[model samples]
Target chain A: MSDDKAGASPAAAYLAIDWGTTNRRVYVMAADGSVLATARDDRGIKSVEAGCWADELAGIRARFGDLPAIAAGMVGSTRGWREIPYVIAPAGVTELATGIGRIPEERFFIVPGVAYDTPDHADVMRGEEVQAVGACLSGLAPHDALFCQPGTHNKWIGLKDARITSVTTALTGELFALLRDHSILAEMMTGPVEDGPAFRAGIADAAGGDLLSRLFGVRASVLLGRRAREDGAAYTSGLLIGADVAAREVAGRLVHILSDPNLGPLYAVAIEAFGGTSTAIDGQAAFVAGIHHIWSMIDD
Target chain B: MSDDKAGASPAAAYLAIDWGTTNRRVYVMAADGSVLATARDDRGIKSVEAGCWADELAGIRARFGDLPAIAAGMVGSTRGWREIPYVIAPAGVTELATGIGRIPEERFFIVPGVAYDTPDHADVMRGEEVQAVGACLSGLAPHDALFCQPGTHNKWIGLKDARITSVTTALTGELFALLRDHSILAEMMTGPVEDGPAFRAGIADAAGGDLLSRLFGVRASVLLGRRAREDGAAYTSGLLIGADVAAREVAGRLVHILSDPNLGPLYAVAIEAFGGTSTAIDGQAAFVAGIHHIWSMIDD
Candidate 1:
């Protein structure tokens, strides 16, 4: 059966864009988040301009044809194409649509990102709010969600019911990038690595206690001749993740990690901390879900 | 009558040389490591022609007259003048003098350093070993000792009695340097800081656990405005140190720290970790004691 709408055959082709500092991706989803035709562009928010963002969107149109779409990430913020205002977390579906915009080709809504007025400074979320919204819609989100997103800038966000309430970011990926690649941790490492049991051992060490000292141990382990150079980087990777888990020490919370698997070995560690109740969503999936949420809000 | 030799006054003057990768200093001591006439020279091992090392001694003679002297640091190693072999820990007076070297008219012995030879690589300590040797001389040293020397490359040496047994180095200072002056942590920091209570609070955080997560909190605190940038550095500093202490939780071991008084705030944090039972030695005094150890070995 050909479901046609708006003078075209319809597959419920909904478009989603997850754009950030260095990478950009676009996906065509069904009414559900099942990816249809996916396309990507290298010109992320940092490298491209809001005016140029349309050009990247053109790439998606070529793959899936003209369709209704929703966007997330910097795509919706003040720096983005339409400057979608942020919705303070704990906002409802109505608040989520406050800053959504109208795209020329399709009826699109830019999801309202989340923010908080912290004591010292205001903490804001752009692309991540979409993920929380997606999680809420996926029916996978736990009651009190402790979202752990590990990446270049790892974030741990909390959601009550279906709204993001609090969030924190960790420069674990950047720190690891520095120590293993730039600092003495590089010396302990061999260039191409298979990561001996040391990665596991490091995870154990981080779990044993002394997260920061153990983190420092990256240099000390190299200096002490306990680990090789290439392994040192892996050790540092484990150190930060282990420390993250060790620090959070979440016993009963339904911890959810929204991050790239390639970023670090944090997902496994988070699972170890939060136990069987832990759920991990791929960065791409959460992003798509976030887009669907914004699209759903646009019609409302 | 004290080693009375015809017309000879008791060796009233003693010389000490501290030479390392980038800096060298000559100190004229009153046979007790007390500074008398001190001359700081720029020519370190990396900069000096080894053949000129003898001339450098003559230059010392020109500054403080003819005097018996002792040399510490890398000066005695293969990198410096006449290679002084390493002495395994539990080093004694006789074992130390076995590596003695004398320039005509100057009585001296270069202190033997220590090294750890493992399967992959070995770490050799040239100067720190001397300090550990000095630490061994103290009457308080037990069969097993834990020495903490805080600096750019913090050293934590584990000794079995008199012999310098095993050791580890923490890049605590280096991390602080990188974070405060070079990395992301610098972004939040402003002007000079007293650190104050934030320092202790950071330590307390490490003690609380989740070192990796706590480290992330350093950047979060500042970025979120929970802490002042200057205080962020201070807080991060304490967190790193506290993580180290909390990680190395040895219940009954005697913990002794060799550090400059300038690190008083950090020392206060260390005291909080190791407890008041932890004893601290002045870094300057340890330098003197180290040189004395080398000299006594020579004279004996």
Candidate 2:
């Protein structure tokens, strides 16, 4: 089971896992960095009971063979399978590799998340660091660039000289979901969120006032009959994303966006609307690539 | 039963009701503006079953005796008993009184909410208008001042020459609750929210960036051990209210805050922290006074 053994089978491959809050994606890769097999499950760290992660990993190994395993994302956080200290930025794959936490029983290693500790704002990211590293390894990222990972907790990372130098996080997506599902505005949003005029109007509204005030317009617009109730979701989405993008320093920069297909289009639209050029990178591809690169850095 | 009878009993009084989304407060007042008796129930407009508001009112009357009742807040909203149109500002007691919609079967009148319609932002308020008017009649408001009503939907009303000239709203309270109960940050928060250093630190964090970015710090601070998890609620509250207050144009103005006792102290702390002076007014007292002033303006 241990890769350090004197003689290993030819079928042995590295297992790269991105264990996040909601999903766990596993990549089986050969020594030359080509993917051999893959598996995924909804048993994210949030779903696993405490002290049961070892059994969960054993279950995965039962199906995919007990190859040397490396994991990233929330799996390294205190809430995850095991705690790995955050390697403070500016850090890249080398520094991150040095901070890897290990599980002796299963030959498993966890890549540390990165943190930016400053007087103004403090930010941290886990899986995104792997994605950023992957983007760099794949030549999708520039030596100096702004990378955006939009999701529940959207991150705007500043990369320089192939290292993550700075990080900022926005709770835009989470806030939007909270409002859509729990706030008074939920009643007004009854249909699918369309990318139309109402969405743009929400973006425009973000520029007028603070987000706390601007959000109220979602309900007011419907009550006034100015907007259909069905448009509430799109409009709310635009307002949150628009405000988030506007607050960034991306007026004339090429922002590299790593997002799932569902969120990528919306981010691209907002980035363009805010006077920035955006390149959408597939999230899963970047995650796999990043995990693979990290696994290669480990010595047998 | 009716106040309009040719020879009415001496105990007949005007009943003022402030029926909001979560709570219902009834104030029985004499013609001279003194509170005779009061009652409260959790049966807000939201809790009342559809087509049963009349029965609810009858239940209140059955206990307190039939009287000409005037109601405000969400009870007059589209989802309430009957939809009363908003009276656009700049408006005061006269404009609000003129827009009152009557329920003929029950001898009930509902005061209209106020709306601000501009190209930039649209805002609507139902119960806060009653609070604003009450503050004015009670001589708690200055001729030109900012009135802060802190609750689920906190309203900041701009009063000029004894009339509500402008209005702004912040979803601070609502957003705080949603995040505390539903969002990822909820797990970090467990104890009652205290007004302490953590709360002030959160307010300071709010002054640094957009709300979307600042909110993420709540989780990061706890995760990094920079702040205790129990402090999450207070910190989040401070961040929300601080961001809201910081965005307003009320640095030097005297702000009259009409709020329930629980939230009033927090707003006072935030208002003072943001370099503005604030006066706390009892919400129930204001509602009763506001409804009395509007009722007295009615032409019999």
Candidate 3:
């Protein structure tokens, strides 16, 4: 059951696994980098607190046949299979391959997450920083570019000369959830976003100045008749979303590495607010490229 | 039962009431404007709804002997005794005066609420608007200023030349409640407010950028090792209050405001974020001044 010889020969395949605290994903690629097949499991590091990384990888190999199963994420945490300390933000794919193996001397490269530990704060980027760096390469940009990956936790990473030098995280999506589901703003809001006037209005309200006083209008607008109660949820959602978009430096002459176009409007809002240049790229695609880039680095 | 004689005579005692949506307060005052006695009750309009205004007021009077009582809030709503039409914004104190009544030929005044009608929106202010306006006249400079009243519902009111010109509301207080009480943010914040690092961190996080993003940080910070989960409520509160304060004009030269100081450090936050002259006044003291100011404006 070895994927290395699943199709024909021993040198035909390589495995890439993105394993994290809560989930695991793996891709077996042919010599030319085409995905030969795939495997996924819920046996993330957090769930399988015991030594299940080997079992999980074995399961994937049983399905796709065994190959060099490289990995990333919490599999390398202090509590992970092997403690691979995160590479500093300025490190490149060069580090993702430097010390990667199921056990050293094997033909596998475990990607290193990026970490930033300053005097006042500490942050980590498990798998996406590499993807972001790879995305810049996908777009044929220079070694350096501005990378934006939006999700529950949105990261604005600065890549200088192909190295992720620094990054900032924004919790825009989570904020929307709290505001709509947790605040008095909830009373006014309903589900599923029927109208966008409140959303647009929130964006406009957040545009120029005064975050608090303008916030007063969210309630006042509804209570005082500026908006309807049902629109309240959307308005409140927009309030936080609009504020997040407003507070960030999304627009400036640079390539923005967004996850997808669904997050486009958010970045578009940032561009509109700051008068900056932005480009959207696929996060998953970047992940693939970053995997290959790491392989290239390792093989070189 | 009759303040008519007292109204006609210089020595007659008069009662002023700041009956609001959820709480009732009464002040027995001498003809010279000194408070002789004060009491409060839970029979505010919200407790009984609009149709029960008369019965509620009668109960309030029952607690403190039959006396001439001036009432405000829903008592003037369509649900209360009479539908006091809202006076236009920028209207005089005389304009906000509603349900002003007197015995046949006697003198007494029931303060009126104000209202504004605009092409896109309309607003109305009941009981507290009078007090806030009174605060504007009695305690503030004789010019235009914003009044910040924080509570279950926070109000940002504008005054022109010591008169209540217009008003807006922010549900910062209520938002704090909903977020703390119902939302998942509560699970992580299963304790009393530290009001120290947690609260300040919230303010800083919220103050850092778009509210939604900051809001998202509340959950992710906990999930991602950036912030403590127990601090979620305080941080959420700060994010909202910060958004509330940021909503209006906090910059430029003439943005002076009178705010209640008991709102923890939010006053300083307002001052720091909004920037201009601000005096953190006591809400309890202002309540007295509010009653006096409105009563003084009563036409005798």
Q: Pick the candidate with the highest DockQ.
A: 2
* CA deviation > 4 Å runs, candidate 2: A1-12, B1-12
DockQ of 2: 0.71
Clashes of each: 19, 0, 31
Error of 2 at B187 (Å): 2.1
TM-score of each candidate? 0.74, 0.92, 0.72
Query: Per-residue lDDT of B1-300 in model 1, one digit per residue for the tens?
Result: 111121123445666777776787666666664555555667778776868877777766666666666777778756687676666544544556676665545465566666554442234566776666666675545546777777766666777655666655556776776676666567755545345688778777766665544565665555445777767766777777776666566455557777656564575455555554467766555666667766755653
Ranking by DockQ: 2, 3, 1
| Per-residue C-alpha lDDT of model 2 across residues A1-300, encoded as one tens digit per residue | 222231133655777888999998777767777666666789899999998988988887776767878989999888898889999999988888888888877799999999988777788998899888788777877668788998999999888887899999999889988988889888876667657888888777776548898788788888887888888888888889889998895778889998667777788888888888999877777777777777777764
Sort by lDDT, best first: what order?
Answer: 2, 1, 3
Cα error, candidate 1, residue A60 (Å): 8.5
Of all native A–B interface contacts, model 2 reproduces a fraction of 0.82
TM-score for chain A, prediction 1: 0.79
Instruction: Give the alpha carbon lDDT tens digit for every residue of A90-154 in model 3.
Output: 76777667745445444445677777655443456677766777776666456778776766566
Clashing residue pairs in candidate 2 are: none
Candidate 2 chain A: worst 10 consecutive residues by lDDT?
A1-10
Local distance difference test values of all predictions, in order:
0.63, 0.82, 0.61
Top of the candidates by lDDT: 2
